[model samples]
Target: MSELKIVDTGNELRLLGMDEASKLLGIQKSTLYDMTMRRAIPVVKIGRLNRFKLSDLEAFINQNRQEAQS
Candidate 1:
């Protein structure tokens, strides 16, 4: 099997687990799942798991902020 890698998007970091991803967004896991179901957030799916990148999360936040400001 191939190894999973998370390269620097200008910063060193690894892929985030569901727990970390939810916490990063300051939302509960259930809420995260709800958002995913609503297609409000992007995710990386490996097999039956969900993963996220720090940069993508940041960009998501930025995009939401812009939308809210508009």
Candidate 2:
């Protein structure tokens, strides 16, 4: 995956490339790819390319968030 910059239009869903998604999640590209392959993360297929939605990524983070046991 390349560090491709996706254009954002008003009222349109924001899509990100693998590199951007990995960076946003603070993980390596390989890890992200593994998660995608395992179906652990939501991904969008754009005709031979992988894309991630900003809203979906945010939802994934929220779903996986764990509260600290104090």
- Which candidate number would show the highest lDDT if scored against the true structure? 2
- Cα lDDT tens digits, model 2, 1-70, are 2333434564468788999999999999999999999999999999988899987777788778776787
TM-scores across all candidates? 0.70, 0.81
Q: What are the runs in model 2 whose C-alpha is more than 4 Å off?
A: 1-11
Per-prediction count of colliding residue pairs?
Answer: 0, 0
Cα RMSD, each candidate = 9.1, 7.8
Global lDDT scores for all candidate models: 0.76, 0.83
